[model samples]
Target: MLLSIRPSLFAILLPLLLSRHLPTAASRPAPPSDTWRSSDRFMDAERGTHVAGLSDLKRYFSRFGYLPEPDPDANPTDAFDDRLETAVSLYQTRLGLRVTGKLDAATLAEITTPRCGVPDNATLAPSRAHSVGRFAFFPGEPRWARSGPIVLTYAVSPTATIHYLPRGTVEAVFDLAFARWAQAIPVQFTKTANYESADVKIGFYSGDHGDGEPFDGVLGVLAHAFSPESGRLHLDAAETWAVDFRRERSAVAVDLESVATHEIGHVLGLAHSAVKNSVMYPSLSPRTKKADLRADDVEGVQALYGSNPDFSFSSLIESDTTDSGSAAARRGGGVRSSCMGFLLVLVLVIVI
Candidate 1:
């Protein structure tokens, strides 16, 4: 049966589905590029030097799961305290940067880059918790529990702001994105003209769209997707989205296919990867295209959905022995487990 819940119901269930993911920094307007320039005074403090805004930067780092909650009773200072240094070092390490506690230019550049709207860490789960390979799962490991062969339907909103690319172009980008995943995994995604009835709903919305997570204009966050059965994927309509890098270079356009590929990973129950080269990596630079999936990406999806019959694991990389089983059995078992866990909550909602 096709699941066609109303958007309002989606909003109600949204928190439950996304309870573990942290909020992106979209609420605050992203600063201009100069704010993070190499010569900027943002990190004027020398290594082992005390500087102003350490407290503020500590709070920001905490938001991204780099640092723990600041000590409430501790006195605030401009000094680059040991706690702040530790946090900075951790952040650098996680991003695969030079592991200097100091706020160096490269670190500054990474911190300032535009990224997917999903938070770098889950609020409820610690970073790198319960992960398989480099790819992680959404808070509670929500995934489509298919017990049999199925074609998951997706629909692109006709109302999408297709200023940068025409509707047909955008549709092809999504088709390519879905095809890329299907080539590796057993699942197939088909594009449908029916918006409401589609299993996966894709659209672009600006600012407060009533889904709690609002898009900030321009270079902060490009897009975000809900995990599993929720089937909600949203792109920030404000970005200059592009499919062709050469022609759209003047606009420094964000590649629609790249973002779609990453967002679709989320739709398939894969969270952001800490591996920088992986498509699931949270950040992507302007005018950059990362449509190709890395080895880590392949291993991640295959872990969840199992590999496609024609896709050979030995041909790519000899790591884990492939588990030949029904994709539906793996997915169906997971879905049943998840439903049984949430059955009480469902009953409570219905009774009230």
Candidate 2:
């Protein structure tokens, strides 16, 4: 079957073969959609009625702030995170989502919309050039950034950028949220004077965007991030986004900065703490305010960044309450002590 006997055909095929082995002139993938993949199978574990994977729990609660304590002893058939119900009923009630806790198609659609996180990467041109606060990342690559202070940056999709608080008022509140964390956890957590100049950068993205972790459109797994050098903090652009911070005052809202602060803590290498009051708690509550960064938070950050030069905002940041900020925050509950939580950290670190 002499299919390609012509000399012209042979010549044209030679260039195609040679091009396959040539080094890419532009770095990063040409088509961003190339990274999208099937949903993480573990998501089924969060079906809410049974045994669950810790990572799956993180992915699920990430959609909301955190998952409320479930009765693990409950029947598995009714509990696990199934394709039908993305979140539990009590959870929907707490977040003011019809309080049904059951994630119907409409509810699922609302939460999995593209406005939720990152950007719609329907089209990705080789970024004309590298962005500020950007760095190199390859799968399976070992860490390279300085182990010390760092700043992470990622391209947020235009749609999801709203989550970054582009509105002046929201941005201000969001900034204050981080400032509260900075003030609260200064004992251990800190950012460099020149965050824009830090060696490490955290970039937040959305959808089946960069880093191979794709958002599963309202079904399972809201977001994911790489540790340290991965410098990638990605949100599922398909998730429902309620970046509103007036949660305590209003019916349903979320503190964008609060979650950002928590994820950034992960970028700094701190893991979740069981201490419920700590900002590092795996899940967050609608009732929680920026004022919720408790003593456990300070202890966790102080563990990584040190004190004084390493950490120093005000001893008051670690105080149980404050009178300084907004009237709404001032009237909030006073500080919560972690007597057992304190002992827990000391014990976990093997100091006591």
Candidate 3:
């Protein structure tokens, strides 16, 4: 009787155990190849070259606001015309890259990087062009209007949560991300249970889920948030979003908090920054984490919202340096002991 019961119990528990450990479709790494990364072929191509794929590059330019939208009736061609040259020059200038009006290696490299869905040239006016510095704003400079000290409430969408990450973990990561911005600015952010009533709503979506900006899967567009008062932040569900880099070792895993913090900057009225080190910079590399606010970031946000009285730039730098050093030390130490211990327990449970 005892032997028969043991087999029955094993049969029941085996499926449960496998389910817990197995990777879901959402957790898996994106495909090894990306369509946008194919722009590598145009690495040395320049104006007047007329490569067969140059037309595809033109569509890419139009997507990012560098070039005007193609006419519906006209057919796109392989010609790299004067318009393409001007657009490339403008892109180089905005990103602080060498202003070469050609599709040089550096330009192509930057073009293929995973970036915020927000257009770099949104709301650009001729008069404000000269006055804008390293940091920029969304066209009319939209910002959350407030009368006094205000507390903004944000909620994670219950219907659109990611499958791999726990709901609590997502909330915690977002909480910390919001706190980082609140540390520098006078605004306060609090999590609320009400999704409908909340001032800010965040969701993870794949493909076209409405609101015009559709996610292009994997490393193409990591995420996008609407400028001020819209309070809608959407992350691509297809990417492997990792909270702990040590555990989730996928080469293409994106840092969830890093993205959250960056998008929050967008929700607060800041546009993409020319300063690469700043949080508001358009692109982020895979397997890399960058959540701290640089001086450029702080200055940009503070211009829109007054600074927090207790904020100290010197202290922030010291803290960030110390934290980075400790993180590096941990990474150099190899697999964490906790992970090893957990694996040991898992093996023991299976054996028993």
TM-score-based ranking, best first? 3, 1, 2
Stretches > 4 Å off in candidate 3: 1-52, 122-133, 316-352
In order of listing, the candidates' clash counts read 1, 31, 1
lDDT of 3 by residue, 114-134 (tens): 678888873353223334348
lDDT of 2 by residue, 151-254 (tens): 33333333334332344443344345446545533322333434345433333344555565555443234345455554555544333234443323322123
Compute the lDDT of residue 314 as modeled in candidate 3: 96
Per-prediction TM-score: 0.66, 0.41, 0.75
**Candidate 2, poorest ten consecutive residues by summed lDDT:** 16-25
Which pairs of residues collide in candidate 1? Answer: 51-78
Which candidate has the top score in TM-score?
3
Q: After superposition, how far is residue 103 of candidate 2 from its true place, in Å?
A: 20
